[model samples]
Target chain A: MRIRVATPSGHYRTPTYIQGKVGVIEAVHGAFRNPETLAYGGDGRPKQTLYLVRFDQTHIWAHAEPVPFCQNDRLLIDIYEHWLEPAPEE
Target chain B: MPGVHDRGGWPDVGPINKAEHELSFWEKRTDALLVLLSSADRRVIRVDELRRAIESLPPEAYETMGYYERWISAIETLLIEKNVLTKAEIDRKAEQIVEQRTIETTE
Candidate 1:
């Protein structure tokens, strides 16, 4: 799954580092109230699916200063379903 | 400016300090206060509200204050915003607490 890290003119939950980054959905943690709306005191009903998304350390820091990567290098982030979309087939 | 709490991937972010600290008594109390305030009985505030409140902080304060202070700041902000407590009341109570502590020290 590819998460959209687009510049939303306002507050957002998706971290910038993973924006436009491709990752694998490791697990789906079921529907959760949307923090985006809840943050503003709105009832975040119609819960959204939460997934444990995994990104390769190398993939996330690819553009940054070259750093070392290991075989087990992986970062797992909890992300809402709305933030994700089908990754373009490689 | 992006919310300072919105720290994700920035080229300049320092390495994550993994050191653990033995929490002080007040820190533990503050943590408990947050849980109590958010609990069902009180429901004085919600988790998301606290997050928004923390992010509502001045970027400098958000960046400079320790995590517990951030929680304290947010708790204070929400209490006042929700009309559960006035700023003056908090100030006076805090002063009173400090004064009592001073007296206790002298005794």
Candidate 2:
């Protein structure tokens, strides 16, 4: 799956280092759009988009899996092209 | 030749305890950790470097220094979130590292 990564608007925890990088979809963890503003204690229906992207190790390395933290068991990340390969023809 | 006798009275001595030794030590450790974390290939940091950095700290320092944990956690989070290592793979690797460390210390 081909996806474009961009800085999400509003309050987000994604690091700024991966603002604009293209990454291949390694796996579709699942669809999760949570509008529950539990942290902010607000009723605002916020759109939370999450995806797990396989990034290039050469360009960025911080939370590279092989380590675990929180529900981040499934990390949502932005990857670069160098780490991606063209999907095989169906 | 005459250097020994040339000295006047005694040289002035400064207070040794004037410096914040603990803070300074923490600053140095944090700086070193940040440098390692900032690298594009942080995961590749040699085991020696990691061990040295961790060892340089005082035992109580680890608990007091939340930033250190944050920094390391951030690095790991980035890698997993980016999918550099899958959840399962990362768990396995971390377990292996722990096991290796345990064995090394035991012997």
Candidate 3:
């Protein structure tokens, strides 16, 4: 399903590895962002755009050549919907 | 002007309330830095990208630039503690991914 990711403007801990990259919606974990931190002023409110995105494994490997066992590692992108798109068929 | 006791006597008026002025200056700087840091962490852009954005600001702002240094350091520390960006690398691993895409498309 097409989903939107949260993209808040600020200093965040999202790995540079996932920045600006698109991923498939492996599963939707619900919306959330760290609200207590200075980023959210401790408000604890989940950012509306935040979603757990699973990168297409084949695409991720093609780009990030993972070490054998590490291939299972998932990319949790804190993104806004504008950054995502439908995965091109293989 | 007049020496302390020469004119009327009190402590001479002093040079523009340096302490208060400095405090206000730093306070504003700190607030600005916080806004930028928050934006960067919210996934708007990478930290280095944010730094470049800050550098683009006017030179006068640099007078209080120490505030930026402190804020960046604090944010980096927090990110490290949370296992986000590491000291070893600043850019994301996205480049490698992009490269792979190029190879696949060509083949």
The lDDT leader among the candidates is: 1
List, residue by residue over A1-90, the lDDT tens digit for candidate 3: 233233534433343345444576655556554432434334434453555677644544465434464556665455544445664455
- All candidates' chain B TM-scores are 0.90, 0.38, 0.29
Instruction: For each candidate in the order shown, give its overall lDDT on alpha carbons.
Output: 0.85, 0.45, 0.48
lDDT of 1 at B84: 93
- What does candidate 1's lDDT look like per residue over A1-90, in tens digits? 899867754457887777788999999899999988877667898799999999998888876776667757999999999999999999
For residues B16-72, could you state the per-residue lDDT of candidate 2 as single tens digits?
Answer: 556443546755675576576546686343332343344334546543556456445
Task: List, residue by residue over B1-107, the lDDT tens digit for candidate 1.
Answer: 34577776645767789999999988899889889998989878888888888888888888889989999889999889889999999999999999999999999
In candidate 2, position A2 carries an lDDT of 38
TM-score of each: 0.85, 0.26, 0.30
- Scanning candidate 2 chain B in windows of ten residues, the lowest lDDT window is B1-10
Here the TM-score of candidate 2's chain B is: 0.38
Over the true interface, candidate 2 deviates by an RMSD, in Å, of 25.5
